[model samples]
Target: MIPEPDPALARSLADDLAAAGYTGARLRALWGVAADEAIGRGRALPARREAAATDSAVAILARLFFLGSPVRESEASAALTNVTIDGAERLGLVRMSSGSVTPSVMIRPQAYVDEHGAGEWWIASDIDESVRPGPLPEDHVLGVGGASLTLAGLQLPTSAARVLDLGSGCGIQSLRARRDSPDVTATDISEAALRFTRLNAQLNAVDGIRTLRGSLFDPVQGEVFDRIVSNPPFVITPRGADVPAYEYRDGGLTGDALVCHIVMGAGVHLVPGGIAQLLGNWEYVDGEDGLHRVRDWIAASPVPLDAWVIERDRMDPIAYAELWIRDGGTVPGTDEFETMLAAWLDDFEARGVREVGFGYILLRRRTEGSPALLRFERVEGAIGPNAALGMHLAESLRAHDRQARLSDAELAEAVLLVAGDVTEARHYLPGAEDPSVIELRQGGGFGRTLAVDPALAALVGASDGDLPVGRLIAAIAELLEVDPDALLSDLLPRVRGLLDDGFLTFAGGEASPSA
Candidate 1:
């Protein structure tokens, strides 16, 4: 059932939770580190046991909501004096029978630290597989999982007038986007998921978020916004009777058509100069590169866009099928598991699917007559746990926009400075003084590292916020007894890349501090 929560009771419950110090940090502290980690691995025994030992408000809420363990009605009433058991029932959060209360939905505290600051929100969603009585229903609303948190941190830090969150499941991205945007529109295909979004908004006391019911871009037709953020339903699933098509992940399209549709929709829905960021997966079929396929999709866009797409990880057809099959709560040795696996294999074989690529995508609508920047790369690694990358990305876009207008002669006159987080690493063979390899590594942003030749290394070493880049290049050429013009020609293109990547910043014209 799609819950229609009461705002009044939600407010009262929020106050009660605040009074009890119910939050992610407090819960993890209540149960030691091992117990917390074990909970994530689908075992709630430690947490249930630890929380059951106490009758404190935090414990009471945790046992009822997180662990879904039954709690005495009298104890719950005492813990939430403001919103007693009756009030909770009115809010559609719990059920009462035989002097005990059981949770209908899981209401957990999710802590977030982004460009704005650190804060917590109460999220209501369907109980996880670990706590559920059986396999989830088709339309299960998910909580703050890893993918949800990732797109949250990627939201731009700058303020916006309006933002659109497509496929806004549980409203996590919308909540995060609301930090910097005054107006937010969250859309979804499932009314159940939209109910969860409304429930979370009320729990967090966040206003100005309007809920709409529709598929991707359907609700916001003919509307333009300054920014759009989406953690869409991009997971790959087979459209077979044996395989479950969960609403939270699958988009009900054959192959990777759903992801392609979302990418193409950005062209019409976004205003000129507006940005749209989403997470998606692309297919690698026989003799076709997944990244190239994305480039083709961008080319087909009705509007011009500057795109920066990163593929973080890839999985073969068998591995991908097994991972998602396990996610559907089917154990490997079961008959149902064998049936689903066979269906997945049949689907992959029909499509000639070789691999699947998953990652982040950012697209900005471009103005007419302006050159659009298109970057497609693969970076397979780990980012900070909850690091806010929006600030770094904004700076990079600004740098690229500024440098695109400068010519070689103009750029030569610009002063350059190495970024503060940049460091140089040198490696030499045993018993050798001259280094065989030199690398420039960034300590922030995407954590990029680049190799450098001797002349480029000398130039970067000399960029200490003083002198023009051309002057430094000429000095390096003179030191190496090479033609200054040839050296300048060879290094200026690389310098442009360095500037765009945030390894170096222009210290001239309007970009300078003194200017």
Candidate 2:
């Protein structure tokens, strides 16, 4: 009988690997020798008997190495399995139902940290050569990738007793949360992903990262979280098809279905006053507003929430369709590639999707009667500290709420002073002198320049929070010698826009949205 492998033996191998300069390519070479030895003898190799052998093997593979390469798998089976194929099967070293040993079944490695090193080692899926490969292994660990780190850093810093990392692929976000929060629960649809998360947590020296296997929100029923973070599969897939094996990229939904569903359901899972922050994409319909769609979803929600939605970037349908197709490794000239691309465009067009917009969404639960703030604005770049633009928005929301209870005269008395650091400028025509243009420019914080009509400019100048807006407009009309009706008609919209953009603020209580 083959001896059971010792976990310590794996650690020794990893140490030797570090000493031997075992880059990924060199590790594969060593793995081939090991596999050849086992296959040539046609028998199951005994479990590692000596620390030296394990060390020697690991010294050649290194901690940064991933052992799932096909060449390495072949080598591992040949070196580690018994010469007698049947003996290998009896030991659970290889599945014997198939006449020949399959690398997937026969070549399994026990990942471990190098004895002298600090980071953890993990086993991952062997790169698949198949067209439509099976889902990732139940314990399939992953290499560090950009998106994983992005989500980790983007999470809001809050100490919560309980936190949830939904769609926790490779467990990177979960690990970060566990480091910051007292308790963390991670969930994913793939069993392999869950297993990988567990292994990764252990590797990273993080304990208490609970792993659950289920779709988003399904695994955490009846549980409320102080903070919930997700980097879910937001890519809208074609209809009637299972997405590729990369669970990290595919949400298994068609045309913004996943985003809408998640946003609509998130409120139910959050504790009163809890925050839900997520990265998502929405399809922009030709006639319907994208912001309005998200607003409608939140409005239909059974729970009350204050929401902030920012559209960071948008791509035309054709460009969006082709981007994901290429990401899936579809070659443009191939027939299969053409079919997939065509399908994506057809579906998008059928749904009236003209553009795909990506953004960050933040929602907070509020008390009854709190007005929900739904904002849709175009941002210049990626979401990060550079996008710290949202910080002022929180203050703005509070100000608006305070402004709501004031009387019309009190509102009129509210003087609109430009924020500190804002400068007012007047631009004159080159030759013909009509009314000079009045512009307000701000150097920072939601940078914008607005062209103020002469009447509105005079009213804004006169506003000292003493008179109501209606009387102020009337006074400004009298002073400017213009028709009050025409001035009000032209200036009302401009004033509202300025308020919305944070250029102007009411003097007294906070400013609320106009009905």
Candidate 3:
């Protein structure tokens, strides 16, 4: 048997690992390689370390890289016997177990460090072992994953004095917030998760991250926040009354319970002019509007809040069942797999869940008493991730409120200025004698095109916002010698469409009559 690990020795090893290029990107790469090898080889364990000299940093990484492959606890212990697994455990480098000893070791990457090179090691072993209990080994670390990064990038840029991260798994979102905010308090249901959050905060060299252990806002009662963020465990599962310890994925409530609670409770916790960002899923009940459901939650809150809810993607009941069933590592063609799938479908159908909608939800507390709901949906583009769009949406909502308070007469007096590089084009029909098409084109970003109706085109060209839209239509009819009523009927709808599409907005200095 290997000798018991010493705490001092483990600290030394951790310091050395930190000195080497073992943290952040390097650690992620190593973990990725190890995961790939395990998945490809189907091996429960890899080769033991050969008692070679650890002179070169690359040599050590190579040894650890090979040793990191998913395996039985005994196999990993035997392989890295010289490294003192217990010592590494004490230093938060590896999580080891003797029972069922294949390889229960989980290596954590250091949280902070800028560059990727030798002697900048930042990886750490995952410490939240009690939260998730299972044989599947890859779900160990609290490293930055896709969903964590997604929610992080989606946060508004304004700095807050106090920020709250609810259900802060692994504390990734809290770390991001602490980079800008003065204080961050992260809450979770698991004590072990809180410990990991504290460790992760230290690893990132970020200070003042307080960890609270409780479900949602229990620990933060009577406290209001400047901003709140949560990537809650909103997955809908069939294990009614028998919730698993998978606190990271199971919210313990059935059919959008967690999301409703978060949405309803966020307003109470947000101070005036505060904001909250959340990523969650809501089940689709037949004939019910998911957007309206969220709207009602906002309406019920005492705090007046503005909300932007986007439904990114929807999955049908069968598709949803299959996807999550496979996620549990159950291979199809097996009895266990079929039974789990049946249970999922049955649960979904019994609850009348036709589909499930997933996306990002952003809420901001209005100043004192101006509550409004703005709901829109956009299919994610293929170009890149939609994280940046969330901030843009927030900015737009802020601008919209400013625009809404303007009076119609003030809107008429406003100059209709266009964005940079906007150009007008006239395309005439071939030889048939009709006038050419007058189109407005914006040459940047999505390159939006607007085809102007001939009569409306004349009105826009002459618009200094000096005349009301109805008078402008009348003036155009007189100038072109057309029927005034006929022109008004044709131009109104087209002009409204242009305004709706963002081709027109009031210019600065155009004060509303009400103002």
Candidate 4:
């Protein structure tokens, strides 16, 4: 079990870590980039080999905290001047036995960048599969992983009065949310997880994050926040199969019911116009689409909500079963692995589950009558490198609200500028003077590609902020010999779409999307 966090010790440890230059980038350079990447996939031998020849303070800390290897007591004492090796043991960060210090928890540097800026935090959590020789304990507290980082990046960069970090495993999301909001409430069912959240917050010297121990919304009942961000334990696991239900990924409930509960119950705790962003998994039953099921969940809400759900990935039942089984430290071709796979398959068959969809969900409580935004789509392709969806989502939400209030004539009178990241791609048949296909591609923000006709292409190419949209449409219609009114009627809605998707923006609002 992790010890209760003492603020004085945490501050000392933070100071020592900073002095030793313990950061993600520095560790990656110490080992080759390939070895660093390998550690993320639960293979630590490469990094272990690379660290064997080094005895620097950073290298020693990397071996103990990152690779989960024991370090000599003398070396650790020399490195941790402020925290001291004795204080570290007292804080339950390590165990000293036979002149060696064995790390009971892992503290590694996490680097992040957002609209505000770039910074690093030292995150502490339970030791991982590299150190444990067998299956993970059912109540393990996980460190920062790919899913955690994805949800962290998805958080909107706007400021808020209060924010909720549901299922705050290691307080990564809490730390990220604290960047925008002054007050953050982090809740989890596991006490160990909540302890890590408190420890992490104090370690980073970030204040105003309070921890509560309860399941889902129970701890935050009757409270309304401006934003709620969660990477919930929504992984579908079978019940009564004797399968290990890890607390970090499994929500104890069967199938996707936990996510359903979240969607159906979010409205009562959200103020009008409040937004909640989360990552979840939904099941696609026999001949039924998962997105449609999510739509149904939204419809069942006691209060109306605006939803924009994106399904980033999907996998069949067998593949999903194998993927999760391997995650619990079970090797393929082992008897235990086969047993667990069979249990998962049997459970899925009972529900008529055909596939599972994983993705991001953004929901907003409608301040007034009826919802305005209802977008459900699949963006399963690769996006541009370092895409900043948080900024894009915030901008798109504003654009949607702006366009919804405007009449067709008012929109046409507004000056517009094409986004800087957009480019035109034309395809032609051999020996043809005119192009057969025209496509506008977005380099960021969902990486959308739209096919356009000659008139639309000409209008976009000429959107240089000098003319009103109406005038540009009139000029393009004249060039194409089409009726001006007819062109306006056809392009008005499409232009609205472009504005909503960040392809085009109102003249003075043309800030480039972040990398």
State the lDDT of candidate 1 residue by residue for 85-193, as single tens digits. 8888877788999998988888889888876568889998888787875567788888888889888877878778899999988999889888898899999999988
lDDT of 3 at 217: 90
> What's each prediction's TM-score?
0.97, 0.59, 0.70, 0.97
lDDT digits (tens) for residues 1-515 of candidate 3 = 11233435544554455555555465335435564355334332322233123334433443443244333454435444445555545544455454422233344442321112122223233432222233233333344455776787677656688999998867778877776588999998866566657655554456788888898899999999999999988878887432222567677787788888998889889887788899888877878766766777777767777777877778898888776655554557877667777888888888888889888888877774453546555444332443244334444454455445544444444455343435778887788676667888644322457787677777777665455666777788998899988887676555544543344544454332110
lDDT of 2 by residue, 1-515 (tens): 11332233333333333445444444435445564355233322221121114445342122112322122344334333323334433422234333334333212232222112223234333232121243343233344444554555456544567889988876767766665577899998977667656655543346788889899899999999877888888887776443343566677777888988889888888887677777788887988877788888888777887787777778887788777665565656777667777887888888889888887787776656655556666666333333324334544555445444444445444566555646778888788576588887755545566687677667666655566667778888888888877776676656655555666666655443221
**Candidate 2 runs further than 4 Å off:** 1-147, 241-246, 369-371, 382-515
Worst 10 residues of 1 by lDDT: 506-515
**Cα deviation of 423 in candidate 2 (Å)?**
11
In candidate 4, position 349 carries an lDDT of: 97
The C-alpha local distance difference test score for the whole of candidate 1 amounts to 0.86
Candidate 4 per-residue lDDT, tens place, 112-133, comes to 9999899999999989886667
The per-residue C-alpha lDDT of model 2 at residue 274 equals 72
Candidate 1, pairs of clashing residues: none
| Candidate 3 regions with alpha-carbon error over 4 angstroms | 1-18, 23-67, 70-87, 95-142, 241-245, 369-371, 376-380, 412-515
Give Cα-based local distance difference scores for all models.
Answer: 0.86, 0.59, 0.61, 0.90
Least accurate stretch of 10 residues (summed lDDT) in model 4?
506-515
Q: In candidate 4, list every pair of residues with a backbone clash.
A: none
